[model samples]
Target: MVEQIVEVEAEAVAPIVFWSTENQPERAERTKGIIEGFTAETGIPVELVLVDENNIDSIMAANFAAGTLPDVAFFPLDFAAGWYAEGILDASAASSVVEALDATTFSEGSLALVDTPDGPTAVPSDGWGQFIVYRTDLFEELGLEPPTDFESIRTAAEALEEAGFIGIMSGTDPGQVFTQQTFEHFALANGVSLTDADGNVTLNTPEMVEVLDYYSKLMAEVGPKDTATFWDQSRALYFAGDVGMTVWSPFILDEMAGLRDSVLPSCDECADDPAFIAKNSAFVPAFSGPSGSEAQYGQVSYLGITTGANTEAAQTFVEYWLSDGYLDWLGVAAEGKFPMRRGTTENSTEYIDGWGNLEVGVDRRAPLSDFYSEEVLENIIQGANNIDRWGFTEGQGQLVSAIYSELVIPQAIADIIDGFLTPEDAAVQIQEQVEEIQAALATEE
Candidate 1:
């Protein structure tokens, strides 16, 4: 008998490094657990590095220069496309994972957020839409419709104030990014785009002026007097049932249900039941204004594979994460981490259904469904379908990043509220300033 030589490709055994921007101790621990499960299932080791979100850009830059980038990273949506543009991301690795998982299973909004001509710059993991959580009981008592648009919101705020409740609470801290986020939700509702189809700055348009005027008036007339209220103030006041409505992220869902001890409800009704406010509240995920269609400001996080990564290993890891380990990943912060992948082709709503049942909250645990009605939960899910952002879909993520970094919109809103600048003046100033920034960016290229 003649002996025949047989050869087989060896499986990759190289350990991959995974960087995460979720540096909070507890969040980091949860991520580590997910990584461990991935390792055990595939025999592929991963090193989890917790990095401060603030330092991500600088650290990634240094790693790029040194040619020592990690295999994969869990980063904010803001950096994904920009990094891919800089050639620091391995698009092939992420694309392969998306293909393997079946692209149709993911959220359309999430995928579109990071899309490029080549493919998705990164794989979207999860996200939450900014919410207008309101007093459903109060609206019912006054015979008011849900606040689905600017006119309705304004009417509701005025009526609620007359009924002895603070009308609305929104972030006004000029120096904080929360203020930008809060204002962006209203700006988007008013059909304000940072740039036109040709990438020309259009911040001075009538629609933006109307948005500024409306927002400033609402905050001045019925909002808190301090003019510096942020997320904490708004959330606390709403939980106390002293405010008619407040702008917040879905993370407030678990807290409103009295899931987290540190931020339990304090309303008078809560004396009888901790979830009183939750039972009385309703959420408006997206709203519209006269000049605009309905929309919501969504924030999504992405999993990016680095350029120098062990591509095969990184791809496998990401696929595992979005498949067998996806629910566990979303469970860490279920309220905020809405699943990007809805489910497999065979079970379209599997992940969404699983996500709804995952326990959320710190100190104590309960599924959001326990405190919210099925209709309310479905409302939140539907909101994700309307997620929109300025400049992102227009291939201007870099400019969007610059706008946030400079806090231009927040300052403009602050000036309007402070009486230092008229809405028209703020619009002109914003247009000029953003145009200047856009010009400078153009020169760099």
Candidate 2:
């Protein structure tokens, strides 16, 4: 018989292909470090690539079409569910990884963001809260309560506008998702469930009309006259002390504090204290809407193991991600990272309790515990539990998928605010467009 020598090391070794949409260089460098650590620990190499977040959808779709999909990808929950329906996600493998990681240790609400009717379409990673980041000094100086309601917001905006500053700064670009996200963040509080309990599209309801009217007014009166800016411009405007408030992801925390010099460039005022802008800012997690319930958007993202990937090594990476490698991952941007995996069964709450202690900023290390009160953090965490948007709550991910891909609602909002149509007319037009999108998607399937 021929010599049967088993090469165990060569047989076991497999390189993981990870496509990350972390475009920022500073952040990407830190992420690379974590991957390096993983390689050292596991002896499994990772082929890492930095993808453009703006064009990730097209890139991923093209890769899939060519049968060249990567082993893993950092996918946002916003569009993952729709992809799941196309049988593009490996839910079976992802669900098993979740179970191995200890499901209870992760945030139930965050997991629900990625959960499909079949099961979790992607493995839950980390998430952040969406809320209003406003001027603390201005609010305190004017004796204005938090912008938790429409009336207070209007009052604050008017006062700030008179002081020779923009009252509000939100993304209004017609083509960008920022405007749609801003609209959802604001309307969710107004009780504008874009879809009803049975997953029916209800974008043309009276409540949505009210939401659009208010949004248009805010844009016309308080927002930047340009109405063409998105996150970077809006963030610069706020940190430079030219705007009163902005609605954005919690990722603003570190940038507001001047952690990454590459993005959210430091203002002249920040020369004295790097975290000056962060200290002067006030955060309002969510506001009580007409529905009497304060709703906050939980923008959860996942490290999904792509279908047809090397499942064993992919599973290994995920287990490491949720366990030993987790702290380092969150440490890269601790300011915004709310722990999705709270802890393991051995030490429940361990990760969460340590999360607050994670320091922020480049020159200084200030714990989040010191930055915001425990009560405030608790309230924000509570909001994470109720996180649901139009297509997110019901099994209507397709409706949301269509709404975003087609820019149906964003166009309607732009039309009304830019004087192309009235609120009622815009609503009618959007409804008609959504119907067309549904038909197109159905035909494509």
Candidate 3:
């Protein structure tokens, strides 16, 4: 009787590799927790590997070469298009994942950015919308108010500079983050449109030159000496109290918090604490430009599943991540890292209270409600999707690396800002370089 029973052991499920930037440990940790929870609930054991930002591309490439890419992977928006084009990804399968998204709940712009001709490549996870951050307390102390438009921003910059503070912290690095912050704002302020109705490249237009001129003059007046270096360098100067204002996104808030917690304990110990610094800080919205309206924007990154992922599993993960429960957790873990879904953001008293308490202008603050809404979000998504729809074609990455990153941008920035060349000369050089890149890309195509 004791000798009767036989049992079979369950096979172990393979681990899932997750590639994420170093910028988001909180989101990554939360995601890992969620995956673990899913496995516990369903007995679908999956290990999550957190890849460093530097090694992600190479690792993925090696995996592809070896025919062992992760069962599921999260890719940055910039790299997703190339991955999709290389037959390394299967967009058709990804579409099924998109179909399962809670469309109405997501920001329309965010959703739109991820949509592709082949299908939806990724899910919209977070965004970086530009806002002019100034010192509210400083404004009050200087007997000034928050600037309403570009003219006022200029006036404030001048006043701040005279008062012994650099007016703005701007960087001229060719990386998309720095360039977008500087270029898009300037172009949009001057009404320059980057893409036409049919999505063609319009970088060399007169509007773009005007925008660049405005940017050059503005930077000359208030920007840090080495602005052409990198955004992080500029941010470091700002946080160290070397500058009075800057154009920034939610990441700035996180940086400010870290500074308070680590760098200046006295400032942290003050009654107002973060609120005091934040009060010193105010946010300005995008201004109207000449060719286009001033409210110009662009996309930063997107989250999407790997093409070969299990559709059902990917859907469940995306849905869960976008759900109220997960977003609430994210708000706590990552603070302003990810924008909340519409309903949750609207009804949630916490978000309203948090944003309301900030020193941002009332109008600029009001749009925080619509930040995750369908309309504004859609514009961003569409704009990014249009980048590809326009002239950025296959092999454009290499072209971007060589021309924009390695040559034109660096030369232009140095020429215009460092007095090496005049703005007019720099503009002409930039145009010529762009033309060469376009010609080469056209030939390759």
Candidate 4:
């Protein structure tokens, strides 16, 4: 539980009140280290308030109502546009910081995702793309191709099942956001979008229907019998060599390599070497489907200067965050925190190069490069700039927020898997429900 401070005592010259959602002890320590460096260089003291990611929205709302929103907030992409719409974010301040830092240095894709007619809704800091990680050793023995697309994935899953092994482990818990993210990744590969340019619901399209059918059939055939399986189950099953493939975030890199004691690889080959699975695993950073183009579902965090911010100080801190303090920030969880600001114009790949060498892992520390090859590293870094989501660019961020908050897609998926609805019917159900949500939001306005 987050400690509730009823009031923030003000200094003669107020410290920059920064709200950060990375509440883990290690992550909070790393954040403090960066803030210390910032103060040493710029003499701008910052009070770091660690906010739980799950509680951020409600906390921010309460703060907004009380006129106590922090000077700066490190928050998730899902809230970026919605907060901006609610007049909580100071877009002009965020945009000015981006401009002052040289906008070209940032990942164009990151910037594009939050771009508004006015300017950026927030400064894109860092993010990770979802990955399809498979057992290369098993694939080699079974003569299966990498699971890069729908058909290839299906083929590999079926082959694994026929060989008396579990085919895949992916999120299935309808109540969890991981399920939404997992399904969205597959849907994006199949050219699924929440809406078109004019903000119309597009979930009932043929493409969506095809994706639903493919996903439901594939999961029903080779996935776990229980629908409660989620990220933890998927990762644990993969580490145990019980599943041929698992879709996961890059944060699993260290844990897979046995550097993290709590979740080290426990495969048969790992009896002698915990890194066995890490050595023989292959990753697909981005992939395409028969109906759609190549894409990866990405989640980015942003630094928003709130409407109640100490503007000049907030901008300065943001610039410091994306510049001098950037690598230190990324080093906290290098595997997941891919740099949204790649590097300075002078050294085009400076931060990327530095990030590759930064040490990761908890029980044992080593750079990700020590485990993953240069080619594998490049796939993750390069793919950072090619991410997609449901509706940020379509002026439908509010709708996307509504969809996630209600677990709309996950509900439809659960119904399909339970035989209560066909993929075709699920598509229409999703469309009508989302349309109603969009309409309700419009009415509230």
Candidate 5:
């Protein structure tokens, strides 16, 4: 009877459910380590669910309708804004958490992105910087200038293609969110906002049409045979010496350094040492479009505490997640997780400096500085502040989430590539679809 009573009490206790895209793949091992450590020290029970970014939109939607939202969810700020509008997020709790942790430690850009008249919509955690990476060796050999603008990139890609290698590779697969992300990276460079500040549809504008034309023509002419390559595939192809350039996130840098242990370094010069990729590649933190304005895409990750949950336990989890357990958590993808909150309560630059010093994955654990210079790290830090995202500039976050769920932009780009429509017609259809999604979101509000 005594044992039975203990079992009953334990079963009755609520588990702090959490969700994250980081809970899977190569990062999974490191994630498990941190979560286990958090539970061991704090005695807080957690139930973590892993969701891929590609499918998170649908899964989150279903969870939202069923009221099965996790106690804590790792999501991008724009997506979190939609949940806030639906009353599924607690802005008060988020603000309180940020205050308790001392928000000044965070990067200024991240705070600006999350700040709202009502308070922050999400607790800023970290950021992933995206940019175009190319083979410096090839560019030097061919006497090609760096791909700093749309025209220069085109010129370089064509020249590289003539040399029997594709010019560039990126996320072109519609089934993956990377496709939309890749499209947005280029589109944002051209100043394509999916909607205006008044929630007006703006995807069919002349700028958007030009951007799509550039993307489609580039894919059709210079991309890999599968042009549908997502992040991993694109990264792998570039690493394999199959392509001259790629647009990717910082997460791939360690793997490029030969640290991850999953795939052997495939670049031609990497045969003798896996670190060859780190030695030969060039980084471009931002690029310009025909508009003459340069922009870098930033994905700011956040940890949100949901409504109607174990408040104390959730707050404890958030505190631990941001401070004590932060290094272990970010180290899972340490290369990509540029800390949003710069330091712990202990020291101002402690965490940020530690992040930069974390070793890249080579045959042995070696700091990235061993393979590259301070300029590479500086470029990454600079890119973190030049965030370019749609909907944040306008109040159309709900529409952003809706478009993501519907994959509106990806489908339109696919139509144009498949010979079904011209860029102008495709832009019209995309605008109509986005307008419909906007109307539906407004009705829900």
Candidate 6:
């Protein structure tokens, strides 16, 4: 008989813990599914911890104090860089992972969000680009062409409003993500940027004021009366067939799926059923303003491994998640979630078509559908990268948020929009707040 020596096997280790905000159920589910799939293939177990986004600070603090930080974490873009700066994250190893990933696969703009001093600290999972989703059928009905500039957008809005529909749908309410809707579009239109070379704030220029003035006028005219109440309320109004056109991220395509099932049936039986979004909406690149300027777009979120994580395991996870196959799955699961890598195919077109078909007032047209469109994608990538080149460190993101929130910039903008204060007055108020913030930061430095 062969040597009958009994050998003991090593026990399997537990999978790394990954934490994320439970804000969007679908996103959470998609992430969970992917992780589970990875475990199934690799026999690696993963535990997911869902937390409220607002409570992340307390949770992270507690975890830090206890030396029990998660192996991997999904932090907001605004705070991630700062964490990296404080040595709370292992950026050097993270950079190696980014280097190993297919750099050419990602859009230049999207990759910039994750690029850090030590290296690319994270991989972007989701992001919002400035795009105009308009009613195509309505434009055709009114004999109007798609607008290429800000003035044309205004004209189109006026025409749509005259046809017994709200021209534009935007939520400009204070204490909301109104900046995403207003400042992004306005700044882009006027070619105004938030930061200049050398990482200095440069929003207090004549171009910025002009852009703000344009937004103020737009809010007073075509914007919904209740826009000041909420940012997403406009989405509801748009889906209800009351609004003709709107500017929103591609995620709106996903949200519209549920709305169509729940709301379309009821609307079909109503008197305006046929006329309600008769044609599917189409997305176009945002237009330029009178100054012939175009601003860089914004990045929404990114994914990275925590400094405390097992380096090899974290890299393996990041590689799997950033792979083309996984991105395709994510596109199907989340709809408008575009892939960061260029030349990668995804299931986004199907979702886009479905949402486009449901739109009543717009002709079904596809505009700049390619994620790598040079004119649009390239510029966006450049701007995003430029942010980092200018040294707008993660610390700056926190500083920006603090200044905006504490000084109540939103309220001041609202006042300007309401004509209660002049643009110059608002600018001065904003400048004073910026100076105060600078002084405080100087002391810390």
Best prediction by lDDT: 4
By TM-score, the better pick of 5 and 6 is: 5
lDDT of each: 0.86, 0.75, 0.53, 0.88, 0.78, 0.57
User: Model 6: how far is 234 from its true place, Å?
Assistant: 0.9
| Model 5: per-residue Cα lDDT over 279-320, one tens digit each | 888888788899638888779989888775576787788889
* Model 6 quality (TM-score): 0.79
TM-score for each prediction?
0.95, 0.88, 0.76, 0.97, 0.87, 0.79
TM-score of 2: 0.88
Worst 10 residues of 6 by lDDT: 1-10
After superposition, the stretches of candidate 4 with alpha carbons farther than 4 Å from their true spots are 1-12
Prediction-by-prediction clash tally: 0, 0, 16, 0, 2, 20
* Tens-digit per-residue lDDT, 313-412, candidate 2: 8888888877888887777777667778888899998787777777776555567666567866676655554566666757677778668877777777
Ranking, TM-score, top scorer first: 4, 1, 2, 5, 6, 3
Residue pairs in collision within model 2: none
Candidate 4 local lDDT, residue 2? 36
lDDT score, residue 440, model 4?
97
Q: Predictions ranked by lDDT, top down? A: 4, 1, 5, 2, 6, 3
- Per-residue lDDT over 69-121 for candidate 4, one digit per residue giving the tens place of the 0 to 100 score: 89999998999888988999988998999999899999998888899987998
- Judged by TM-score relative to the true structure, which candidate is superior, 3 or 4? 4
How much does each candidate deviate from the true structure in C-alpha RMSD? 6.6, 5.4, 8.4, 1.9, 4.5, 8.3
In Å, residue 164's CA in model 5 sits off its true spot by 2.7
